[model samples]
Target: MNASVDTAGAMAPQDVVNLARYPIGDPDSPERAALVKSLRDYLDEHQYVALPDFILPNARSRAVTEIDAVSHEANHNSSFRNCYLSRVKNPSLPEDHPINIFEDTSNWILAYDQLPDSSPLKTLYHWDAVREFVAEIVGEDRLYDNEDPYQPVNVLIYNDGDRSSWHFDSVNAFTVTLMLQAPEAGGDFELVPNLREGELDNPDGIRAVLEGKGETPVPVAREPGALCIFRGCTALHRVAPVKGATQRLMAVMVYEDQPGVVGRPDVNETIFGPRVAANG
Candidate 1:
């Protein structure tokens, strides 16, 4: 039942070391062609891609465990709201461009600088594996390049109830969600794709949903052990109320335009407590 040991019962203790314990990708096996092909097709035509056994089977189990632990540790009595974003230092674009305009309140959580390599919940935003897959689908030569070469990775965990509202992520490219655990009911991920390029820009789409001015967002039910990859930058999405005692758990790996970038610090401290710097 131990993650570190292989099938033969050989004790390889280091094999199970968390994110920091191991490198992001194995350069020797640089690309998984079959995986890239299928993933590319899924991303091209659909708003989301579901990858089974995406993580090492053992690692997936670990992720599930960590997610449950965080949910149990949740301040249930604490204010239940919608979505939590990784904290950044300067959330205000200009001196006073309505900081409240960007304010998001979805029952959620953050695992930014606070989690360590040892923490299974730490967001591993490694771009190598994802970039390769994306490049294959979007055509590396055609996709938009990140100004920064080495992109920073961050993981997001959501534990919300009926109050979890609809919203969109600021990052504009593909967003990866690895389902570590599934809720019994509700908790479906609904999306309004191409909002970035369509008549519905994110701000307006979110506003429409909040104001009840438009139709309901499209729904995408994510199952445990399935990788949910979607273009969320502009798309409006939300986690419907999580029913049953078991909370929904997902390992969200996100890439940023700027590596090592942190979202609003005050927000981070407010929700997940103080930030803990990751060891480079």
Candidate 2:
């Protein structure tokens, strides 16, 4: 079998050669096939897909509570602002460069690679079900396993007024954002679909929209349990600042190719540090 999977997510005959050793999708069924096709079509033209209540119905509540608890803990334990994987500072990039941009306080937090095995978020360390789902979507034989993995878990809890600026993923793959809870107002997810064909192209066009200089970008409002898969590498996207008194919490599942790997001194140093570079 070939290693390539088409937009339909069907593997090429050549990839079938190694199919036995590599499990693709799980609980392979007609429903799963339909879900795969829907996601593919959505991304092919629009660069995004929303699977409402994507987690198995039975697991939905647990996932929500678990994510919320983690959000609560991170808010109290780490820097008041964003918290990501620990990494070294980048001297190569100019201090003013976007790569070097770091917030003094962030609304983001890393869920993977946490210390003290019993931490609330550690359940994700062995979240086999979630790992399998992501692998199938990315057509990877295995989930990323470096540092944290090409695919890592993160939780963002935006308490009133928190917002993530517009930016593109530095890698060549997609990022999945699952909303666990949303504020009463604001906190909408916005994107310019398929803007990035690949590579490290900057998504200034999408930025132009956010700046009110271009056409309106597509918006996806993530309700509780809404799982959105976005080609962050190509699509320009951002979260509107949170509004209302409630917190807007989301679980971001990130994935990239092996080639897009980067080593840093501390993961917590960058706003998007856990993002691996595209394969050379």
Candidate 3:
């Protein structure tokens, strides 16, 4: 899996990833094997893992430049919703119920189709070794790139004051992301692990947190060029409000369990904004 011998259509590992440290391209190397095992162990224990400098700094800069050129076109969304993603209050429930608590969230996103072909983001995502390495870390036999035109990859942009509200992913699965840029302050990621890991519901724990009376979820810091794998499904997580002038950018990569999977039109429209919604 050396860069010189990479087959057609695959990006050179060193071009995007720091192979000297991670050695993702060298599958047989003991260092790579141990790295995967340690990553898996950490994820198994914390339901999340982040590898600093997973992407080369220069490549990250290029990806940022590419995004800045199209920043004006990024899809913008701002809304107030409960963890369940419902904007309306549940009148049937008490006013102080978790369902009645709404939180503010805002951000912009660049869909996969919007990125230019020269984007290093695409190069890293297109690399099979990257996907295979992710599979190993997540304990999956294999992972397939999402076939959807707009969902396969995306750059999540968080400007000053932007944040995501505490919420659980509707579906239970792993989400992969790479940090391209980080805000000067705030924009911290907080996770409350296993909030609803199984059918069992920890109402007291969830209700306490929603009421701001529970244990504070520790913030996880990820620097630029870091790759993060998170099991946010069933876990209440959120990004704190960003501060300062620097924008926080994270590349979210989608990997499906099955092949040929595309996004649902209605949901896709909600995430990708009017551009894809109009064309789709």
Candidate 4:
């Protein structure tokens, strides 16, 4: 199927995305096909793809302002634990094992449910063209916006003394993230590409990273407005601590291959504070 603009015609994909650089609105367009192929190839090779300046400047600026105004409404939490973001201890593992070792400070998060109805971030996530483009690039027949209101989208805010501990996202196959604001120093997105593949566990590899003795993780240097598509299920990644006064803000766009998938109530409470009644 040829990728086309949204049926609603409210905003063309070209206007929201940088069509001149990365054409993806029209699937019939050679540029769009080539871009999708390249992105797929990159993901297949490295388990992730980073698109710099994917969002246009005006739209990005507006989104940043809108998010900043409501930043205070976000929930915050801190934890010390392994890469999976879980603090549970496995009695079978050694005390010094990576699974048991805790490093890095707890980072703050701003849940997406807090955003106002008119938030640009929400609008962008619901765009049909954007969803279609992402589905095509990820080789999914179709993608649906997450049914879980709180887990559907969010912003990770890293303030001073805030950093995410190394963790793997085994829950989701792919993650789409955008940088809204960056701190003056630190706050680099680090990843050990393909550290674990398929269902096979790489205990030694995970240990090496936890012990700081593994291959140097690659640091993704991204500017505001950069879009990153990551296969987090296999690639272990984390955000370094924020420094200076500026806080690091990132938008996470969540999607699912099937409908009716909501986040676990316990997990949702941990990440997004209290949960509201499920959407009808």
Considering every candidate listed, which one attains the maximal lDDT?
3
Clash counts for the predictions, in order: 17, 28, 0, 3
List lDDT for all candidates, in order. 0.49, 0.54, 0.84, 0.78
Which runs of model 4 end up more than 4 angstroms from their true locations? 1-14, 275-280
Report the alpha-carbon TM-score of model 1 versus the true structure. 0.60
TM-score for all predictions?
0.60, 0.64, 0.92, 0.90
Ranking by lDDT: 3, 4, 2, 1
Better of 1 and 4 by TM-score: 4
Candidate 3 structure quality by residue, lDDT tens digits, 1-280 = 1244224543455788888888888778898899999999999988888899988888889889889999889988889998877799979988877788899999999998788765788778878889999999998998888878788889999999999998877753898889899999999988887777666767678778877788688577699999989897767889999998999999999888887889888888898887766795
lDDT per residue as tens, model 1, 173-266: 6677777677777778887666556433444454556555655677775666566778776566766677776656666554444434444545
The regions of model 2 sitting more than 4 angstroms off are: 1-28, 56-58, 67-106, 113-133, 139-142, 145-151, 199-207, 256-263, 269-280
- Candidate 3: segments with Cα more than 4 A from true spot: 1-11
- Per-residue lDDT tens digits of candidate 2, residues 56-107? 3324455555555555455322232211122345688565433444433237
**Candidate 1 off by > 4 Å:** 1-31, 69-105, 110-116, 119-127, 134-163, 196-216, 258-260, 274-280
